[model samples]
Target: MTPLDDGPPHGRGREIWLLAATFLVAAAGMVYELVAATLSSYLLGDSVRQFSLVIGVFLASMGLGAWVTRFVDRAVSGFVWAQIALGVIGGCMAPVMFFAYAWMGEVELPLYLFLVLTGILCGMEIPLIARVLKEVGAAAFRFENVLSVDYVGALAASVAFPLLIVPHLGLMSASLSFGVLNLLVAGISLWLFRAQVSRGLVVVWAVALCALSVFLVQSERMVSVVEASLFEDEVILSQDSPYQHLTLTRFQGRTRFFLDASIQFDSQDEYRYHEMLVQPAMALAPRRQKVLILGGGDGLAAREVFRSADVAAVTLVDLDGAVTGLFRSHADLVALNAGSLNDPRMTVVTGDAWAFAAENRDSYDVIIVDLPDPKSIALSKLYTQEFYAMLAERLSATGVMVVQSGSPLFARQGYWSVVHTLQATRNPFVPGGRLWVLPYHVYVPSFGDWGFTLVAAHPLTPRDIHLPDGLRYATPEVWRAAQVFGPDEADMPADVNRLQSHALVGYYSAGWDAWFK
Candidate 1:
């Protein structure tokens, strides 16, 4: 191969353009992979499994594509066509997957199909670029140059995807934008090698570019249409935050909030869930002056906390600021939470619950854990014995803590595992140097047979609990009946959930799968 220095001036210019194309295409390919994995995790439940499968299939397909490039005799045309194919497939991936989930109720087949196709096309780009550079009389370092630029571009994509793309542009817009990038690379390639390429290929490139440009411009509308199809009600708000996708829907004067497609609450009956979660813990605690709530970003739990006149100050720690911000600012959402998030007694801290508990210096008169179900490892960490121990350290001598465990009927073992973990917690302030854990349940029409576990230094009974006035659902009789469980809902043998084991995630997944499937 002739060195680039010995090549014609035009040859060096072509080489530079090809290298730049390599960088852009590589970045676009990585973003496509991330978008697929993120969408899969959002629609499906287990994030770890979804991401691992996506990455594995994507990498394998790339290897297959590289191997097939040996059969290609026309490297320039092959590379150009590959870019167009990638541009179309990668760009339409999110919209198609969302529609598939909305209409078909399953995205597994389409998800894998797009991943394999996108990965293969991405894999074919670099080798074909190297071949094209060699044909243009470039230096022997052409392969190294292409590979290094490709890797750096991939690094840039990985960083920007979470920080910028998902948060700012969202999955749909990000996919469409990168699709345009691929088409632009193809158009540029056609221009650079116009003398050698066919005019027919140029026409194809022009059409693909125009079509992708239209989609990129209308990406937000496309997302809205797809989201509207997914929900039964009108989508009032649909947003992508750094942590997750949030969607708010309303129908017949009832509002519903969802995180990553899982229902967080329904305004019509959310008071039942919130009142049951907060009332028992507040009534059992020796004092209710200073309360700490974890993972109640919607402020529903805080609303219940404020119902008690003794609550002088309440601190809420949740991971997502978007959730808290929406509840604090949106008029409808504010009314649902009864304006508790904006109350002067409330101090909202946007941070991780585990980290907050680990660093907390003050003890709370009552602590309420209103987190989501332990469906993934990240959420499972909060249910682990280690996390419960941290919470134990932050509870005052006579304070009580309550955790919103999952469905007792659907996730029997999961609910009991939380109870066992809290009971095993060794707290020095308690009478026996361990917590007295009590498991209870409430039946909400939306969730059915939901459970909560209360932890305190000393024993608590139904007779010891008190109900506040104006509560719609929770009462003395309801609290007494919640403590009873039938034979089917009885506790099962379960292992302690630890950070390393993540036993709760497995149990929760298995239990819900058996019920839902």
Candidate 2:
């Protein structure tokens, strides 16, 4: 009988261990892939494109590794070495990419290089493990056992990734921790099959373990250095929440909040953005007793809302708990928003704005959709016709909703597309059915010629404008002039942003590229 039928006495037990190792390595491989994709999306824009390229390159490299495995003669030794290589590469992927992007102004080279390297190493791993298992009395079910166990591990990883790894350990720690797992898998496998391998491998293993241990403890230091090189100011706090990367920076007492590496607001002039976002809708609404804010977890808009005496109750729905919690607890952040989030009149709900709008039975007099710009497919959903339709259902008959449209001078087509989408939902035949929508612009020093869209079920005129108390920038005359646009900021006809088409993303991407790039 061949070694497949009659092997060492403990071969059967080793085969089970081999399957377990396979499960672990598969999970580690997926974690590395996802971590890379997420980091790329944070550094770069357009998550859909970033994830697609990383996955495609990784899978193809895996296939390449599998094909190259045909030339290997020693399966067990090859598998052990591959695991060590994968551990080091996967463990260091995040810091390496961050450094590459911050230093080189391009992540494409290192991103694909690591993907190919890790993919090939991961690809070589399974075939080698399967080959060794086949030689050790598991030949009859090697293919079935390996494939099934690999798939189960992948499913487990897919579930654990978002729920556990991202929220708790974060990208940097998760990568290092998985690397340790890879090292352990390799070390244990080598020890179990020591008689079949040479002694030189032990020295390599010892060095790698020591290096990884030191790196793991200093991961935060490395991340801080990388972020310092990348961002303009000193990063006071940088964390990876389940939803996005949150960074708070301070330069000469000027604080800036960035989500996914995109600046949300700068403290010096934030009032301009928040003031314009809140004032128009609150002023125009017939009643301001009930208000709904779709985003604005920062509480700056809530601060503006509290300025109106008519506001009895305010409901703020934002997806990220980290942000709202930060504003609530952080002394500086609390002071920035004038303690608006802690107001007894405010109720903070940590959930999806889209779902909250649909399920909410209560009608709101003024709804402020202070969401991020349509930079990705996920964010684009919030700006679509479908979302606007749901939003319309939650508004009182005389309510006005203000949407923060992107820059008209920079993203004119995108700005108008939001207006067109809201207009598409208007019903002209019924009384108070025809939606009266107008496009407006405000010039903030931080953001040039920013735009907003105002919508109501009935006709809106100067009579609807009611200036709130303690206003700094916006007055009744300013509110009237905000509706008028110059020749350069003229409105343009664009397709409505529909769920299927994602026209806004395309328009915004193209428009911003032309103006900014």
Candidate 3:
């Protein structure tokens, strides 16, 4: 038998407690990573950049924690006690971060630092657990049993994290609950090994764990305050929608829907933006017959198109059915779109626009590109020259197309790039086809101000537009004025947005940042 086996019959009891303690710690730390990623995507505005940085920072900090484990007091009881403490600290990490983000003005530095600290403590747990188990009579070096328990614990966390924890309890509650698990670990430690521990260490450990335990019960109201402060609005309803948190909030008589803290639509005056976007192109089109509506999942744009008796059928494609269903089923959302979604003239196809556009050909009379602003790599493809080229191939010979090019005065480079891209797109399909660019603007309270682009193969005919009988914002005069760009605003460089380099994205984002800041 091994020397380790000689100490006690199977070191099973010591190993089990060690696994439970570190398992609780690891699970809490993993959820912290997910919450941190979600938070960055919310406030910082880019999913790829946020997720990557959060992951990179967490990994680096974990490595540092393992390195620092070398200095932990070289004693079996000390190591076990330290694991218990680390577990408690890791447990409270998410709720503490949420409150810190809410109470503090600028939370980036402090948030990242705290994430790093949690990762470090999380990293220290396993080694300390193993050391304690070994000292308590685990075989001299039964690597298999130690690794097996660690793997089992890891497997439990992986299964529990997304399936049971995140969506059901949310990040704050999950953290607080894990805090209780840590306290339980500390309690078990005191019960099993109270004889070996110092009186002061035992007292302090018990007190601290018990104090943190109270936070678990009080977590909800605390979370509400944090959420309200961060949103800066009366949060009417909020839910974790798997993909993101879908929040409905109200401020100044305006209702807005937020997905992952990014505003989806401001309800008070979306008609102006939607009308202005869909109308100009329709009015310019020879006949807005078979319309392709991309990104206006709310059906507000579809309602505008249906105004024209000339439109045969409208193809509306949006990625998330949740967005479309909300507008379709919810009374508030249905009322906002003015019941256009119920119109028989529309066909809704829920799928990724990029992939769908690639499969079909020669089907649309007028294509209205009204997708969300390019906020992440996921949305970038829709704004690229390639998407426009596919759209160009799909359009009819005398067809007209208009794109809601984010913002012109502010997104000057991005705006001009779309303008030039459309200009480059016109070819012999219609020999007289000449690309023309028109600029327009609208104000959204939450977004402040916004812009659009009207592109056509031929100069518009006032008669072709043949607007639907009822309209709120777009008129013939408004259509004509939208094309008008003043002298001062004309100073932006005419540099075109090309497929190879997305320089305009940077320019537009920076310009908006400067204007807002």
Top-scoring candidate (lDDT): 1
TM-score-sorted candidate list, best first: 1, 2, 3
**lDDT by candidate, in order shown:** 0.90, 0.86, 0.70
- Maximum-TM-score candidate: 1
Supply the TM-score for candidate 3.
Answer: 0.82
The positional error of residue 433 in candidate 3, measured at the CA in angstroms, is 9.8
lDDT of 2 by residue, 1-517 (tens): 1454332447668878999998999999999899989987887788898999999999999999999899988888899888888889988887788888878877878878888999999899889988888667674764877989988888888889988898888788888888888989989888778766778887787788789878889988888988899789999988878888889999999999988778889998888788888888887788899999989999999999999987999999999999999999999999999998999999999999888978888988999999998988989999988888888878887888899889998888999998888888754334556467878888887777899998888777667476777778887788778888888778787999998999999999999899877
Model 1: ten consecutive residues of lowest lDDT:
1-10
Clashing pairs in 1: none
Q: Which pairs clash in model 3?
A: 4-140, 283-465, 307-468, 417-497
Candidate 1 vs. true structure, TM-score? 0.96
Error of 3 at 509 (Å): 2.7
Candidate 3 wrongly placed segments (more than 4 Å): 1-10, 13-25, 74-103, 136-166, 178-213, 230-233, 251-253, 287-289, 310-315, 341-350, 359-362, 394-398, 424-437, 443-446, 456-464, 494-500
Q: Quick one: ranking by lDDT, best first?
A: 1, 2, 3
How far does residue 53 in candidate 1 sit from its true spot (Å)?
0.9
After superposition on all C-alphas, the RMSD of every candidate to the true structure, in Å, is 2.1, 2.1, 4.2
